[model samples]
Target: MIKLQVIGNLGKDCVVNNVNGKSVINFSVAHTEKFRDAQGNQKDKTIWVECAYWTDRTAIAPYLKKGTQVYVEGAPDIRTYSTQDGRQGASLSLRISNVQLLGTRSSDGEGGSSYNSGPSYSAAPQHVSAPPSSSQLNEPADDLPF
Candidate 1:
């Protein structure tokens, strides 16, 4: 069995469909790779992956909106077909076994999510009491024959 994992922003809102009485959520994830060419020119290449998550837990569909970052893991499949012009086209798709929302893009197109607008951390850690010293070790080891 082959497994694939992808972390990227959603291309569009997820859609839930019922086929043969089974619910499936469909969405797309786009991953962009950045690199420099031989001439030191920066370039980016984006790969789009279609996902189909079959589950009864469709509650998560609402959160799978456009620009929402997510992590998905599943079985990968490549589909190839012929276009009307006799050209071959291929797409990478996944049958999602698990999906999780990572964050969301701010409305102002900022780099962070509004979900994290509040305090970035919790209260400071409390100091813990020190352990017992050697002198405090169990009545100085009572002598006993094993």
Candidate 2:
């Protein structure tokens, strides 16, 4: 089994469709990478991935809006097609098995706050312990061998 994981922002709002008695949520994600070329010139490249989440759980559709950050994991599918000028092109798509909402972009195109619960499409809420208090941090390490 080949699994692919991606963390990026959604390019547009998701669409939920009912096909043949099944529900599917379609969306796209864009990931950008920055690197220095041979001449030491910095460059940025962005890749867009089409995603399809076929599941009965459609409650998260409303949150999958444009500029929303998400972490998606699934089986990847590469498709090749002919362009209008008879050129071959390839596209990357995913059969999403899991998705998590990270954050949303602010109205001014700046960073925004994250979701408090951090809900996942295919899993339940995980237990996350709170950070240690100042007193706890100041305590001696009684179990240390040193």
Candidate 3:
């Protein structure tokens, strides 16, 4: 019943795989923290989280590219194994329940653009249908003197 959420930039493009008739998207996210060390020296540490999203909705997979920011939530999992040098190492992974793209690094390499799952803003009106004609009226207008 433990849940974890991470907001960070994608390390690379997502991979969509078909395993036993089920589709799964795999990706990695990196979060960096900045702090001042004991000697007043600035330091940065990065944490990488591997994510696996199993769902039929693969439309979002195309957009999960490198340097793309996203928010992901899911059940946390820790995997421990022995490295090639006979050293024990552990990695953090998640079975994603939900994910959202936050932004994308701009093509110009200057900044980035924000993203929203909701509808975009438009200056024009959405409904363009005309009003009902007199023949379509259910009831006549009330006739009264001013």
Model 1 lDDT vs. the true structure? 0.86
What does candidate 2's lDDT look like per residue over 58-134, in tens digits?
99999999878899999999999999999999999999999989877766634455433344554556788999985
**By lDDT, is 2 or 3 better?**
2
What local distance difference test score does each model get? 0.86, 0.89, 0.87
Expressed as tens digits, the lDDT of each residue in 48-144 for candidate 3 is: 9999999998888888899888888999999999999999999999999988777777676455554434222233669888999978977757854
Give lDDT tens digits, candidate 1, residues 63-133. 88888888899999999999999999999999999887777777775654454321111236667899999
Cα shift from native, residue 104, model 3 (Å): 0.1
lDDT of 2: 0.89
RMSD in angstroms between candidate 1 and the native structure over all alpha carbons: 8.4
Ranking by lDDT: 2, 3, 1
Candidate that scores best on lDDT: 2
**TM-score to true structure, per model:** 0.76, 0.79, 0.76
